[model samples]
Target chain A: MSEDITLSLDDAQALSLDVLQHNGFSRAHAEAITRSVMAAQRDECHSHGLYRLIGCVHTALNGGIDTQTEPEIVDKAPSVVIADARQGCSLLAFEKGSALLVEKAKRTGIAALGITHCFHFSALWPEVEALSSQGVVAIAMTPTHAFVAPAGGQRPLLGTNPIAFSWPRPDGTPYTFDFATSEVARGEIELHRRAGKTIPDHWAMDANGEPTTDPTAALAGAMRTFGGYKGSALSTMIELLAGPLIGEVLGHETQAAGPESTAKPFHGELIIALSPHVFLGQDCDHHLQHAETLFEQILGQGARLPSQRRYEARQRSLCDGVTIPQALYEEIRRLGSR
Target chain B: MSEDITLSLDDAQALSLDVLQHNGFSRAHAEAITRSVMAAQRDECHSHGLYRLIGCVHTALNGGIDTQTEPEIVDKAPSVVIADARQGCSLLAFEKGSALLVEKAKRTGIAALGITHCFHFSALWPEVEALSSQGVVAIAMTPTHAFVAPAGGQRPLLGTNPIAFSWPRPDGTPYTFDFATSEVARGEIELHRRAGKTIPDHWAMDANGEPTTDPTAALAGAMRTFGGYKGSALSTMIELLAGPLIGEVLGHETQAAGPESTAKPFHGELIIALSPHVFLGQDCDHHLQHAETLFEQILGQGARLPSQRRYEARQRSLCDGVTIPQALYEEIRRLGSR
Candidate 1:
């Protein structure tokens, strides 16, 4: 078989939607999820792109997601919105709730959205970037299944919690960043194990709470958080804010509630939006220009900004389409066939 | 001189207040700043405690802060409050705006406070911890003078921007964490230099953008942010949110506005407050219990929480007072003399 194949962006969306619908997801759920999948593909985020379809299908068939139910949007407070996912994937809930969230932020200067009873399986950048496109600063975070450990401990007590932030620019794409709090992704360690290579000492600790370079020992033990204790603190903050504050499951509970070794974890997400118009009032333009100057200095100093590569890939994908492994394409086509 | 002297908490507050008032600060500003100094001393955060008094006095006299002008509070929107500090210290601005910020959060579910044109010298934990004491989950961040570089760059373009988070518990002190985005404080490297020791490899970079372990070289170059690119991204987020979003100066601008080689930096601070009552409604108590369970698990695994050591020090300080250097006490007293 050929190693690779090329598909236009439209075809990628169609394939994802078909695979999701064939696995019993409703059209609304499938479309919402397909939008995120398309975005990941366009940005060249391979792990979150076509590769995620298999996990979505597996979770829909075996992980107990309520795909048939629609998310219920509620105006919880003057500046708060809640989208109860009713145990479904979070994309649809975010889609349903984010409009009201943007309006409330515009009206009240700041607002929050809580997506409860959700199964989250995508990177958070798409949601934050979408909010920024509407001219507001957005911060989004969620707690995943416990796979990483707190600093100074070997056991898995913390999630690879991710936090995303986006700032709307006067022109062009928003300044955006989304990253996992873990030192490295779980797949990185797995790849090293498969290659029979030693993992970096900072990546994980052995079962005895000692830092180890062996990939196998790291896999048996736990992943370490980025930036040592500072990253650990941030991961904990996400667990508390996205988990308890919004009446959602913690990382360990999310892991236990789903199928054994399930790729999709039942969790919650919290997104906060702030309007620059409200904060700066008439001087919003002046402040935004100052931001441009800061960006100029950063680039002038030969430093790359976050999401720069993603944006470049997005431009390339828009012009030339995306390429994926032929084996993955066949596997997805097989899953989609009724 | 004796190496150390012990003072009761009241004496610490009185000394701080006296020093500020003697150095041309209004009683209002002095009192507000003293509370934070007292809290730092009580928590055994010696660096931010009485030791900061000299710098405060120096900045008040030479750093161009408007000591006589009071902060003007504005209710910009339903959920936004701004305290234009009139070029004064941020403590007074934060003190004036916090009550309204807490009220707005409770009423609307989420709220933000912006302190503009202020000289900030205290740790952010005090502000977030104060909000948590008022039964709200709080997050605070501020941009300091540009002394650190982005992860991939060599020259300084970003601040050692600090972020602090706090969650209220049903009883006792709140769960709080405050840390700079930098790998380590600039003072850490300076201390290594004074002790004639090499700094850590991750602490900073030389002028050529290469990693350096020599303390003098690191001091002459740029401090590295914690966690490489992720920390750099977070620092940038702070620069945008607290700087431009609030219509205030960025890190380099803050440094330029203050006296050359001055210890204090003129900047802006942003604090966000969220209410559990609004999100979980009547089920707030149930969710808080879940948070306690998470805390229990973290403690059970012998992994310490972020503020555990500070709380322990707080207890000891409350029982046995606080210890400081006799030389520093004499210096402060001399500065306060008529």
Candidate 2:
């Protein structure tokens, strides 16, 4: 590793919070935003870490997102709740919406929350993992900017539209799975761009629907769905579920087309939370334990839980300081110094 | 085009219903079961058509399933309901559950239902398509017997767990998608078995975790998940969301373990139903129209809806009767004679 410098988690959070605050965010809002970024870094999801600060800062400054706004609950029923994000950062909106859904599930055994008009929430796994850690099963989806092409199409028409689902294991660790429906995400394109590298041809298509390997060409063109038509169909479902169903506009760019649109990114989200206790009656915990045991039995010794690798990376980083590239750290210091 | 037999939609439905009734089902139950099966053939989903009859019949006779039972609504709230299938056919359970969800969605604008202890329901698309036709956005998932191996695992720990989602287009056609989470399903295995053909290596792994192309070996082993880890993660989500979270026992062979286990062969389902008007206000229909227009504009003349090919095939089958394999047809006739 390069011997430039390293920051503790606390120091990283403080530096990030200062940058957001200097960029005109309230202290509370800045802390919330910084905490989420730090959490991603701690969990080893570097793509969503400090590397994304510039984009988020630009979004806040360009009026594409509001830093101080809060989400408001618009409607509530036995098992459903609707929230208007009111131009807030999606981290705030998602945290609030998830809490409400958990509360509702506690009462009704299951709950669904629809959130509209929010900015992008970095990395979906953390949100679902938070719910799962609270002893609830959670599923979430959000519509995004159009970057992926539908099956058999040449042009981009659907967003990556990532989905996340998680359930708690008896050991308190959550089995979390989150992914974009595209063959590759825009973040990976940015990574390749930074490295001056080419991508696999199947990852994207040029304007005429021919395969392309150049990262620049792929970014200008369209990303393919993960597994052809199946992934394309899933992206369409996310659009329907997160857009029109949540009263948000379809198509990510169209949602942000006008100045009158909320500073929020105009994306929508749906979260479902379920309580196992209601289903398993007196044997909920035992059932989960048995399920995990069976999973281990089938997997044997060498097997790993889905999130275990990331979790171990996080533990190691906590003991030894996290390593950040000199360029990325210098960029963050420059932003804070500004 | 086959010269053997030609049946209109009505005639096909009548014959199927007659066959079920002759096998001792009540007329209403027979009609429901027949309608589901024939609709699969009508929609060009031949894999789920009359070919599933033998399995269903055997299940009924082996005390493995109850053919005469009816679904019971176990719990109801404004936005959610739970239904117990009472070992009943999933055809009845799914239809009843979907109807209830749609009804609740009409009232509350969004609704969800959990269905448990149900028999196998053939062809998930037809149900979602029906909901979409009624202008309700729908998503459905079901957990079944273990047929898929988890990512990096030697043994199968998950069912194919097909998921379906649908939305209505302004042009009066429903955009529907349905697929099993496996790289290939058991139906494909059976198809290759009937043809005395070798399977693809990537489609399955033997019990020892080695890829194989023999149909019999594939059956003895496990189907691989679609796109490896992504599909396996989805299968895990389905198990947690549709099975364990909904009061059904998870894992394969739970039924064989004992009556105390809630694990039926084909068990849990979770369905979500939504009315666009819930969020879109008065412009809901307009939004759908706009979506259709946007999709058309993006695709121009060459783009096709996801299910358009299947629908076209069904129309062609109506005009020119569907072909049936001579050997399979002879086998069916012999069974009937017995």
Candidate 3:
């Protein structure tokens, strides 16, 4: 029963910060990292939450990411902010660039942020969610590590690139959802492998490049993009928009050029913000009403909204606590002790 | 062999215009309509091409679409073009508004176009492609008739709701694609039904709300969104963006509200145009190069680019012309002669 005990969000954040600082990050850097971790845990995104702490430590130790450097931002245009992430963690860069992004978007009706040399290590929803909370319609995209094959191809040449979009509502929780272009996230495959379960046929391909239900083989080979050509095309769009458009490494070249980018685990990120103040004006509430009408119809049919599951989980975790594997908590404690 | 006879692009355009004129469309409106039809036929988009000519005539005659008016355009902001289609065709609205869109996007680095009270009958790619050819990055989203079921629900609540994005290339063909948020296009399902064939189980659902391979049953019920919940969310995003964001009818309400507005066949359309001149500056060539590099890598893997098939078809259609059934040609001729 003790092993099954859960931790409150505040306690988890404190413990995460403590462990991160023990692993050699400064207070500011540790705070930024822990904030994202706690948010993910609150959302019950276990893969990106406390479980990623060990990976973060390993990345820092192996120079896979820098934690302390500041982002250098340049005003490319009245509506464009170009931030050189300085081979550091993405959270800090996004945090530092938020003020400029918000101000520019409000002024111009739309703004774009290109963050280069970012090592994105957390869920992307938070980035756009922050903007949506400010009543901005926001979209965020970034090239991921390559693990997905293109349609009609055997080789993995594209990232399971993810796109996140959010629209502000009057009540303000936002109609927000983040999804990987792949049929299933790589995390799901890992879970299946651990659970000794066979995945559905569309989830991935075996090492021999044939569709396989075995998660281990799927991992050894590549993941399939959802909806065949449509998802692959969307992933391709993300790679170009987040990579080359922002002057960062292409997804296919990420591995081949690893030595060229040892200190950064990610290529770049693109953030777009649109202001209802300038564009929709008084129509924001009107738009929100129509959205609610559709939502009612969806809910009436017993279909959950896009992020409903995560949202429900977040509410539950906030009321109760976040459950974690006892061994993982012990490991974090040991790291903090050191 | 006469059934396989082809006509030049000019002849096809003329023939299409003749048919439309015979059906009561003014010269200006017919020209605009034919331009899109010719482009679709040239690109070998058979589903959206000449096949829909009869339906277009019927729609106009039944007062579902108006052919005797011009769209009223208002420049809401320097970068926002709002066009009231006045219960007319989407192409005329787009054509009338294109100049303002180009000027504003060039001046502001980005622009948004909202066209309301119009019926969109052709593929969306051509809308964005028009802007891409003007050397601007473009995106377009619009709702359709509600035929798609939400992810977990059985009843149809959303449209196919297509979104199109285009990145202008230096060589001028551009990287453009348009795809519906559904698993398969309704046109394809109709084709399968006519051919007495079964569709894939994932493509649609039966009236019993079960996944069905029977195309007729699928048509009787609802089509599924492409990638389960993800596609459903994308569809929802499109519904809001193209509907209320642009001041038009929502998909779920389009049918219910039809009697309220017997004149407008469509809800609305949203067009977003961004200038690489302002955003990329002289680096436009560099960005184009990188895109081409990705295209090369994609081609090397034997994966066709999203619009490559259409492009190839267009080239061939330009050279050899489009092939239509002899019976269909006579039908068109009969309509044109009347």
- The DockQ figures for the candidates are 0.89, 0.41, 0.57
Tens-place lDDT digits, model 1, residues B173-288: 89999999999988889889999999878899887777899988987789999999999999999999999999988897766334566544668899999999999999999999
Model 1: lDDT equals 0.90
Instruction: Show model 2 residue runs off by greater than 4 Å.
Output: A76-78, A252-265, A301-303, B1-3, B76-78, B254-266, B297-301, B314-338
All candidates: TM-score: 0.97, 0.91, 0.94
Each candidate's number of clashing pairs is 0, 0, 0
* Residue pairs that clash (backbone atoms under 3 angstroms), model 3: none
Screening candidate 1 with a backbone cut-off below 3 angstroms (N, C-alpha, C), the clashing residue pairs are: none
Model 2's chain B yields a TM-score of: 0.89
Per-residue lDDT of model 3, residues A1-338, tens digit only: 44754998888988999888887877777887888888888898888899888888877777777677878988877677878888777887888787798888788777788888877778888788889899788888888877898998877778888998888877637788899999988889999899999999888888778999999999889899988888888888888778766667787666412434553466888888877767667876777676678878988989888777788988999899899989888877777853
Per-candidate Cα lDDT values, in order, are: 0.90, 0.74, 0.82
Q: Which 10-residue window in model 2 chain B sums to the lowest lDDT?
A: B254-263
> Candidate 3, residue B166: CA error in Å?
1.8
Best lDDT among the predictions, by candidate number: 1
- The total of clashing pairs for model 1 equals 0
User: On TM-score, who's better, 2 or 3?
Assistant: 3
lDDT of candidate 2 over A1-338, digit per residue (tens): 56545678888787788888888776766776777888788877888887778777777777787777767876556566777777776776666667777877766666778887777758888888888888888888887877788888888778888988888888756788888999877879878978999899999987777899888888888898887777877888877777766667665454442346553456778887778776666878777875675457445824556777788878977987566788788887777754
